[model samples]
Target: MKKYILDLPEFILVALSAYWFLENYIGTNHFNPYAFIVFAMLLLQIYFKNKYVGFLLAWFISLFSLYMVLAVISEFRDFPTLISEGALKLLAFGLGFCFLAMGSAVLMFYKYFPKVFPARF
Candidate 1:
């Protein structure tokens, strides 16, 4: 029998982080309906413990998150409007959102496609 909570794959970890980041980044409740699908697949990956399946989910999430970030930027010229209050905080939050999306994409590519990153530390 295996442990209840074993170490997840690097891609899974990254995907999960990106998922959580997106959860917090979104302003409205239930704004993204597809996020629920990603969350469910993540749960499936955890249950099955299949690296390949996890990789597929992670890749899909990374691409989707990148697409979302790009789409938002193209649609909105400003960060949730140029609010005079807490502008710095909003900027920081926006930067974090972009960074997480980009990080997910870069890590997914580097770790899986090119195998630039080692499988395990």
Candidate 2:
């Protein structure tokens, strides 16, 4: 369905972000199964009918995206040059994605979702 184009990839990114954040932030020594659980559930979240859950999920995505923006900058700040081709490309991609994810989250907050999944919570 047309809706999948937006929702599928959006949640996929959410899952990846969640997984990466947990893995990196918490460290391997303190590994836990929660991240994997989150990744799996997010992948299945193609549709959301509950206003509260949708709002919460979108909020999470937006916050995580902001965190990603900071992470990207901090992770790359020590590079030899900020404008090197690779670095520039990465920065652009990172910013663009965060902008898009946050925008989608806003849309969800405003009840503009495309009905990508069944009722959840």
Candidate 3:
């Protein structure tokens, strides 16, 4: 068990990170609706003393969090138009709407996908 957990394949970690990043990019969410699957699987792994699974989950979560931080920075720097007081009121509204959608998507993904993560971890 230690061997499996300590020697996790790099490809799998990359794959999970890429999946999460791509999913977020397409929908403005920091994570996908399937992200929770990975999370729950991670918890199970820990309960079962699977180190590899926990590592994988941690890596993916870090990647997802990093991406979210980047997105926030990008939005803040580029959405200045949305911050201007009067002329961009409508634009600000639209941006707010997108933010809400992104937040909801991430929350939903975590809520739903944690159960889907495989026990192999």
Count of backbone clashes for each model?
Answer: 0, 4, 7
lDDT, candidate 1, 11-101, per-residue tens: 4444755576477557544445555555666566556656566456557767766776665555455646655455555555655665665
Residue 48 C-alpha lDDT in model 1: 65
Model 3 regions more than 4 Å off: 1-32, 81-121
Ranking by TM-score: 2, 1, 3
Candidate 3 residue-wise lDDT, 51-71, digit = tens: 455444555554565566556
Query: What global local distance difference test value does model 2 have?
Result: 0.65
Quote the lDDT for 33 in model 1.
Answer: 50
Candidate 2 per-residue C-alpha lDDT over 54-88 given as tens digits, one digit per residue, 9 for 90 to 100: 65677787897789789888866867988798888
How displaced is residue 88 in candidate 3, in Å? 17
Residues forming the 10-long window of minimal summed lDDT in candidate 2: 109-118
lDDT score for candidate 1 against the true structure: 0.55
Candidate with best lDDT: 2
- Which pairs clash inside model 2? 46-116, 46-117, 47-116, 47-117
Better candidate number, 1 or 2, judged by lDDT = 2
Worst 10 residues of 3 by lDDT: 5-14
Model 1 spans > 4 angstroms off: 1-32, 75-91, 101-121
Candidate order by decreasing lDDT = 2, 1, 3
TM-score between candidate 2 and the true structure? 0.58
